[model samples]
Target: MALEFSPETYKKFEETVNRYPKKEAALLPVLCLAQKEFGHLGQEAIEYVARLMEQSPARVCGVVSFYTMLNTKPIGWHHIQVCRTLPCALRGAERLTSFISKTLGIEVGQTTADGRFTLSEVECLASCGTAPMMQINDDYYENLTDEKVTEVLASLK
Candidate 1:
């Protein structure tokens, strides 16, 4: 399809642009729309978005890479990002991440063969006070234990 978004997406992009004082300000929202429609901001999609926004690919690429929320590769139905910074690490985030990988039979940055789950080791989820945090989809789990993670995964269909 030569890297194109739906007409509806384009319409929304226009509306988003109109909402902002500067078209460049629409970058984030339009990029968000691109992610929603494409599921990731890989090279092809980044190029397309840059073209849509009249931006250089380098500019758009930087934006995509800056956000952990943006995916550059295909992911699973469930995206699990475990915080691996100091606090979470001390709280056993590494163990929890290892546990999730072992339990799920897929390592970090890899999706299950069935595409059910993807595990990532992120820098910080901004929940140091809670420690040992993991963000599954939009929900965050803090104070993690192997048993807790097992239970959480079990509940997923």
Candidate 2:
């Protein structure tokens, strides 16, 4: 079946488009709406967004690829993003990531077998002051230690 947005979401999409001077300029928010509606920006979602925005699929795809916040595939219930920039690295982000990987029994970029968590080593999350930190779902856990990671994961369950 062809992909589409629900009536309410379609209305929001229209509103979003109207807010922009050009339809092309609304690509980012429209893509976000599509991601929310469709779960992830798979090929169908990308094509649908392209058709709605009168953009080439390649263009839509380029935007998705450039933005780490956009997901091209489904993610686990808890998406754990570890910052790996210089600031984070110096503060033991690497160790934190390794600890998370071991605890979850999955490497970076792989979802756990039970689909509870997905681990990713990403660029700066703009919490340089926090240094070693991880963003789980939408919440940020900063100044992490092994025990803190365990405690956070436990609370999630």
Candidate 3:
């Protein structure tokens, strides 16, 4: 079957378009709604957004690829993004990431078997002063030590 937005979500799409001078300008938020509805930005979601926005799939995809918050594939409920930038790395980000991977038993970019967590190595999250920081879903975790990270992950349930 063809992909589509629910009536409530379609209303949101319309509202988003109404706020913009052009549908093109609403691409980002519309795509966000689509992602929220579908769980990830799959091919069908991309194509659907493009068709709705009167944009080519390539253009929609380009925008999707440029944003780290957008996911092209399914991820776990808790998406853990560890900073791999120089500042974080210098402050033991690499080790923190390794510890997370080991604790979750999944490599970076892999979701856990239970589908509870997905680990990713991301660029700077602009928390360089804290360093060794990570972003779990929408929240930022900073000034982490191995013990702190473990505690945070344990409390996620």
- List model 3 lDDT by residue over 88-156, tens digit each: 999998889999999999999999989999999999999999998999988999999999998999899
Q: Which ten residues in a row have the lowest lDDT in candidate 3?
A: 64-73
- lDDT, candidate 2, 53-86, per-residue tens: 9999999999999987788999898989999999
Better of 1 and 3 by lDDT: 3
- Which has the better lDDT: candidate 1, or candidate 2? 2
Clashes of 2: 0
Clashing pairs in 2: none
TM-score of candidate 1 on Cα atoms, chains taken together? 0.88
Angstrom error of the Cα, residue 83, model 1: value is 1.2
TM-score of each: 0.88, 0.93, 0.90
RMSD of each: 1.9, 1.3, 1.6
**Taking the candidates one at a time, how many backbone clashes does each contain?**
0, 0, 0
What do the candidate models score in CA lDDT, each in turn?
A: 0.89, 0.92, 0.94
Model 1 CA deviation exceeding 4 Å by range = none
Better of 2 and 3 by TM-score: 2
Model 1: per-residue Cα lDDT over 1-157, one tens digit each: 6988889988898899999988888898888899889988889999999998899999999988887778889889889999999999888888888899999999899999998899998888888999898998889988888888989999885
Q: Whose TM-score is higher: candidate 1's or candidate 3's?
A: 3
